[model samples]
Every structure is written in C-alpha cells, then in structure tokens.
Target: MRLVIAKCSVDYVGRLKAHLPLAVRLLLVKADGSVLVHSDGGSYKPLNWMSPPATLRIVSPDDVELEDGVISQWIVKSTKADEQLIINIYEELHESSHDLGVDPGLIKDGVEADLQRLLAEQIELLGVGFTLIRREYFTAIGPVDILARDSAGATVAIELKRRGDIDGVEQLTRYLELLNRDPLLAPVRGIFAAQQIKPQAKTLANDRGIECKTLDYDAMRGVDDSASRLF
Candidate 1:
C-alpha cells in the first residue's frame, strides 16, 4: 500500500461525474491496482475510489495547469469499466509505501460460529418439538450449518447468518434440493435462521417455501449449555 497526504483536487469521469475542490486529503494507492481518495471525516468510506483492475499513471501537469500552480496529476483508469478518477496534485505533504501480505478475512463481531454453536445447543428455539440432527451436516455442495428433525421426523436444513440476506436464503435452498434427493432425508425442509433478516430476504425465503426464524443471541447465550454438550 502507498499512502500520500497531499493538497490536491479530484475529478471523476464516468457514468457519473464528481469533483472535490483543493484540500489536504489522503490518497491511497493500493497493491490491488485500486486508488482511494479519503478525507479525515467520512468514517471508513472513502471520499472517492476506483475499484480494482484499474491502472494509475502520474503525468506532468499541462501548461495551463502549471501556470495555475498545479504540479502533477494522478490518472486512474478502470480496466473493467469506463470510469476514471483524476487527482490534480499541488504538493505532497507526506508519502510512504508498505507491503501488507495476506489477509485471513473478517469474522462478524457477534461471531457466526458462536451463533451456530448456540443454535445447535438450543435447537428447540426453532420450534416446539425440533431436535438437532447434527451441526455442520455435510452435503455435496457444502456443509449445511445445522441439520435437525421436527416432531414428525422430517429433515430440516438450517442456514444460520448474523444478518440474513438473499444469498443466505439461496444457500439454504440449494441444501434442501440436495438433501431431499436422498431417500433417508427425502422431503427435507429448510429454515433460514439469523439474528436479523432483511425484508427482501424474508420475502424471498417465503417465496421459496423456506421458513425464516429470527434468533435472540443474548437470550440464548444466557442459558448454560455446558451440561447439554457431550464434550
């Protein structure tokens, strides 16, 4: 990553046009071939950014710009789109680069794994007579988060998420399709479980015949499950 603090102006040209007047702001030139212009304020969101698969070139300012005290320009071109972000540089206050290697990726603050474990230990939260079959029930595509059986002995595939979205619902649908093909687990049903589910996701789950269940993480955590586990 290359970080620069400079007094510059920015202009974006593409499907939309945007401009940022001259000011001392931070410029981030990432190793991924993307560039971001950020001011000190807007939380984590960048003031302007070019997505990856882009190129950046530093070229001397034009005669008119030079006469106006502009020194150079950083031109960023998106390889995947018609987007362009140009930064007009007046002066660089600081600049540095660093090599940040591999990233393990982000885990949700509430922890999806904990949610899975908690739900597994409290399977009855799903319904009155539901009992857990197993956690991480393996299937052809991937492991279903939780597998359980209702009072009638019908298999139920549950996909748990911290914040449920349409993708989670689709994932559960795929699991159901695969599980139902097995004679032993035939007539498998699906339950999309999450702490909070989006309205659009809930609607999609209902349309797909998958029940949506909102979980109360705090309530579940309050219950001691140490004795319930075989560990």
Candidate 2:
C-alpha cells in the first residue's frame, strides 16, 4: 500500500461529477490499483474511492497548473467502468509505501453463523409455515447461509449478513441464479436478511425480486434460549 498525505483537490467524473476543494487529506493506493481519498475523520469510510481494476498515472503539472502552484497530479482511471479520479497535489506533507504481504481475509467469529442457526430453528420467522431444509446449503459458488421452503412449498434461499450492503445483494443474486438453475429448485426465491440493510441494498434487492427481512438479533437469541431450555 502507498500512503500519501498532501494538500490536494480532487475531481471525479462518470455517472456523476463531484469536486473537492483544496484540503489536507490522505490518499491511499492499494496493491490492486484502487485509490481512496480520505479526510481526517469518517471512520474507515473514504470520502472518495475508486475500486480495483484501475490504473494510476502520475503526471507533472502543466504550465497553467504550475502557474497556479500545482506541483503534481495523479490520474486514476477505472478499467472496468468509465470512471476517473484526478487528484491535484499542491504540496506533499508525507509519502511512504509499505510492502504489506498477503491478507488472510476476515474471520467471522460466528456472529452471523449463530444468527443463521437461530433463524433456521425458528424458520417461521420467514413465514407461518416455513421449514428449514438445511444450513450451510452448498452451491457451486459457495454454501448459502440457509435454505428453506416457504409455507407455500416454494424453495427459498436465505442470505444472512450482519450489515447488508450492495455487495451482499449481489452475492445473494448470484446464489439465487445458480440455485434456480436446478430443476428441483428451478423457481427458487431469495430472501436477504440482515440486522440492518442500507437503503440502496434494499432497493436493489427489491428490484431483483428478492425479499428483504430485517433481523432482530436479540430476539433471535431469546428464541434460541427458550428452545434450549425446553430441550
């Protein structure tokens, strides 16, 4: 990863046009050629970012830019889309590159898996008579969190996420596409269940005809506890 702290201004074009006035900020260039511009705050979310499969080109300031005191510029162009991010650097405060090796990916400490288990046992959370077929139901791409049949006996694939985002919707879409290809599950439907879902994700899921369910984690745990006591 390459990190730079500089006084810069940014302009983004494609789908929308946005401009950021001159400010001291952090610019991050990832190993995959992704770029993120971040302010001092805002947690981990970047103020502006371009995803991977992109190219970054550093260009010297032209005459006009030099006259305006611009020293350098970085142009990041997307390979997968018609998007571009241009950062005009006036002064560099710091710059460094770190050779961080391969990442091990995130370790889900059973929060989501536990939620899936509780939902599977209380399958009726989906509807009055929903029945669980299995948990960790295998598909060609990956194991779906849960698979069940709704009250109407229609196959339903449930994808559980702690915080639903657009990517989660996309993942569920792929699983549904694959699951529906089987003759027995030819008409499989999808339900995207999460503790909290973003509006954009909900809209996308709904547009794709996927049902969105907001899960109550505490309530689910309560149900699990009640069931355990009886057993």
Candidate 3:
C-alpha cells in the first residue's frame, strides 16, 4: 500500500494545526517520502481549499512499521525550551513505537532549554531582573548556568534543574565561591532553582545564606523551598 503522508501545518507557537494560519507553510513529510517540507517565514499556513485526503503509503508488511521511522526532518525553532519539548515529544513517540534512537545531546539541549525558560519566567515573576549570559567560560567546578541582577543591583548566579537533587547545595556553593572570588561577580548572590529540593541540603543552604527555590509548572509560579523560609 502506498502511504501518502499529507502536508500539515505547524505554528510559530509550537502548535500543530490543520490549516496553515497565514502565508507560512506547515512542516511536513512530502507525500512521496522523498523530501520534508518546512516553513521559511517562521509560520506555516495550510491551503484552505480541501483536496483529496492526504495519505501515507505502507510499503512494509506491517502497517505499524510505517509509523516506526523517526521524523527525518524534525524542524523546530531554535529556542531551548521549544527544542527540549520537541525532543521529549519525540522520545515519547519513539518509545511508543520502540524504534528510534534518541540523541543524547539533543535531549540535554532540550532539558537545558526547558530549565532556562522556567528559571527566567520565575525570576521575572518574582520581580528579580536577570540576564542569560551565553558566554563561554570554564571554572574549577564547572560552567555556570545563568547570571542575573538582584533587586539590590547585585549580580546573581542561578542554576536550573528539572528534578530534586542532593547536589544542588554543593553545586551552588561551588559556583557561589567562584562568583565571590571574581572581582566582577564577587557581590552577586547565588541561587539554585529546581523543580524540588532535598531536606538536608536546604538546611545547609540556609546556614550558609544561599537561596534555593522550586518552580511549580502547574501553578505557573515559583515557591520558596528555602529552609530558612520554611522552618
């Protein structure tokens, strides 16, 4: 059976729509499976006139095999969170089909992007101004995630995390030490932003004057998981 994969529309907001919105063409696999179609103007608008239903030809013995292949041209806007969500979505799709190799780098990039976006939004909502410095630098411990400005005009060092981890304190401590040592970042505050926190680590942080918090995705906000503030 010949599978004619129909053209579909994907929007700038990362939403998949039936018809194209404006002049932008949707990203899709060509019917012949020879090439992938993508939008050049940041949006894809599907043709309004209804033509024959788009179909995908099945050349394999099993119809399920048709859906088994990875998307050849996974086109995504270059934003970090958007790319991460795409990788996650792709991972789920691959797992369901049990036939795709996920790129580790891609997954890491996705995760970092998600963390960065969440942290940025949290900082903004919390009334803390910040800047994401995309500079290349090395440290005795490692690379710092984000450097921002606090309410007092002091530099702030922030690290983003997706889940609960024990090393957040130690990790932030190392970065904080480095920041304190640096003539430029010496006065900056150190912070760790995660989806959750560890108990003992939080206590240690409070003793040391470090700040740790959690970002609640469902609530669309940040919660102070600081030990000093909690108990």
- Tell me the lDDT of model 2 at 185: 74
Off by over 4 Å in 3: 1-109, 129-140, 219-231
Clashing pairs in 2: none
| 66-116 per-residue lDDT for model 3 (tens digits) | 233323222333221221111101121111112234324223456556666
TM-score for each of the candidates: 0.52, 0.56, 0.43
On TM-score, the candidate that comes out on top is 2
Higher-lDDT candidate among 2 and 3? 2
Q: Which stretches of candidate 2 lie over 4 Å from their true place?
A: 62-67, 114-192, 195-231
Would you list the rank order by TM-score, best first?
Answer: 2, 1, 3
- The lDDT for every candidate, in the order shown, is 0.84, 0.85, 0.46
Off by over 4 Å in 1: 62-67, 109-194, 197-231
Model 3 Cα displacement at 23 (Å)?
69
Per-residue lDDT for 1-231 in model 1, tens only? 999999999999976699999999999887778788889996545687776668998888553344266788888997866779989999999999999996554444556899999999989898889999998886535578899999999989999999999989888876786566455687899999998999999999999999999987877898645566687
Q: After superposition, how far is residue 145 of candidate 1 from its true place, in Å?
A: 15
Model with the higher TM-score, candidate 2 or 3: 2
Q: After superposition, how far is residue 105 of candidate 3 from its true place, in Å?
A: 8.9
